[model samples]
Target: MQINTIYTRSVIQTMAGKAIRDLRSGGERELRNVAELCKGCSASPGYQTFWSLLENILRRPDQQYAALLSRAANDVDINCLKTLIANLGLHAYPNGSQPLPGTRESGTSPSYWMEPLDDIMDPRMLHQQISRLQKQGTSSFLFRAGQKPELETILNIAGKHRQCVFFLICGAESCCRAYLEEMTALGNVIPLMEYETLAPTAASLKQAGILFGLHRRYCEIESLQAEENLLRQCIALGCFLGVYEGSAQCPSQNWELACYSRLQEMRCNGAQEIFLADLWRDREAVQKLLEQRSGQV
Candidate 1:
């Protein structure tokens, strides 16, 4: 099985490299043409809204940043990109939207925590579980737990389902050169690593054509400026998204609102995506806060 997996990844890496090269050669004309095709597909508001957001992002005044996003888009697998834009788009833009092709409404989030697979558990069993989840509309899986070897197994399984994205949350040590190569080869797995750890390898990751995000835990005492600075640093580091997980110790209502306020500020900036890990926990309160804030604007 391992041998077959290695062979499969080798083939995928070659194909993916060709795809990136093809996309790079095509440049913005191809991307814009694809966007136009999407716009022509459905006159539905959802399609219009999604394409608008994508177009706006692509048209940002910061050409360097915009080009970086454009190149990142080209680098990511189409299925993975659809899964990301579909799942993250809904949260990032809470109003009327439609799930992109090959995406579905996952119940607890397309992203979730899965325990490391034990020796007794057939790796196929996890694949079956993932298949079931995909059937039920879960487009992404967050393997927030597990080590290098364990993650490799999960990535192998997750790679089988191209329509879904599996995120491997790791630290700097875990996200070393070889591991990143393995992930880049896999084509469907993304690294969501510690925010602080991103600096050392951020440039290399971008150069390697890997799309990665940051996982940050915020506390009650963290000032808004501090959070803003961290977010700016994250964007500058070529982070695709910022996963803001609130510290359990700071679960007070006021603290949560404050955190969301800071998050919303960054979200409005339109530089990088921001996801609130515990948003559902305070769904009602946060929804109201977002609504009120949006109205005030």
Candidate 2:
């Protein structure tokens, strides 16, 4: 399917986490505020990615240090970046990045950005990026759990026009914990929610998208039972079914036919919408699969 799938590999998540830690640990070298760095490199994709890594680190500061929270700013590398904290009299973390001074102890350290695909951008820029990207076609917003105020801020920035964006929030329960009332109040913001209570009226849900639930569990079910379960979930969710690939069974159209008995079986089983999410990685492959799905032979 050409529709984008949510991807959260452990390696990528680990790399991002380590990058944030490395950045934080080196704060003793030099420090520039975030705004100064961003103003110069707003259009630079590399810089945007780097700054994004930092904002992500401070996604949720300590409750005691919460009053001194700096979302759009960071302890920057001043040697390489510009400065604007000169006269504004901002509270600089002169002590550099470290744990909050006083807290209840067994004394565990703080962790940041737990979600596998946690991409917490500054709301202002994220709104613009989303608006721009979705204009080309349908796109997704990966909202991390335990970050509702941030999500709400981004939602307000996105404003009234939210038709094209699909929100794939990890840890739906945790998100509900923080913004349960606010979540129900909104027309958009579809977390990976399964409950009838939280599932927005089907109208509020986007028109056509697939769900990839308990992906690894596919191997556990018997082949016949797997097909049946897939069909059932698609019906219950009112969406397409998406699966990961273990082999080239999809694109080759040999073992798994593109124009043969399996397709007929799928059709007979009332499986109208199914896709291999692994193919979504390649633009050309995704377009070809999309064409196949559309019967554009």
Candidate 3:
């Protein structure tokens, strides 16, 4: 069944790619009718939304950030998205839906830092740790490392665990062009780099077909226009998502909610792919959103 689903998705993506090429060449065909595509593809809302989004972007070329959305439609890996829908969709609902028995508490085991010398630095130990997480029904993880070589080793290990998704918290220097290419090919390990540090290299990195998100600290907005400008710049540079880190500077609950609201606004306006994940403050809401998108009750 999995093989058949994969094959169906491959065909769908091929058709989308052809449509993109034809649209570029002044052909009249446009991407539409996602419900038709979903006939035998899958019942998952995530898959349906994915196709609908592609259709909307291609059909309305005059919308805001159309060029960036077009580039994303071309560069983003459909296989990776399918993997997320299949694996994280299962992980999102823990009512006996996970493939493995519980080995740790849900939600807490998904993110990690480079502590525990053996688990992250040693390849064998890292593999063992990931295997344990997999057994614990943890399908996604966020990892941080101190050095470039350590980051490389982590990506290598993550590629071996293709069933799971990994997020690497990286600095600008750590995410070079070659590293971006490696991550792109892996189709699972996503890098979340500090926005200020990566802005200069965003265009070059985008050209390399790298899939990544920018990490920014949330604070009281001094100028809403400036914030929108930054978002437009990020999207124009081909960023598919945003990872907003909660800051102690913004202590008011109202302020935090406001920040999330702004992200939600951006998501609804034109950049549906711009995901804001605040692991420190609102993990539950994030999980619920994932579960909802995955079509799990």
Candidate closest to the true structure, highest TM-score: 3
TM-score of every prediction relative to native? 0.61, 0.33, 0.66
lDDT scores of the candidates, listed in order: 0.54, 0.33, 0.58
Clash count for candidate 3 is: 0
- Candidate 3 regions exceeding 4 Å error are 1-31, 34-69, 76-120, 247-252, 271-283, 289-297
Query: What is candidate 3's lDDT per residue for 35-105, written digit by digit as tens?
Result: 23432343445445655665565465544434444455567665544444344433322232333332245
The lDDT-based order of candidates, best leading, equals 3, 1, 2
In model 3, the Cα lDDT at residue 1 comes to 21
lDDT of 1 by residue, 107-184 (tens): 432222122234423577778877665544345566664466676676678668664566667776556677667666
lDDT of 2 by residue, 55-135 (tens): 543343322111111111122222101111220111111211121222125484322101122465576666666555444
The residue pairs that clash in candidate 2, if any, are none
1 against 2, candidate with superior lDDT: 1
The lDDT of model 3 is 0.58
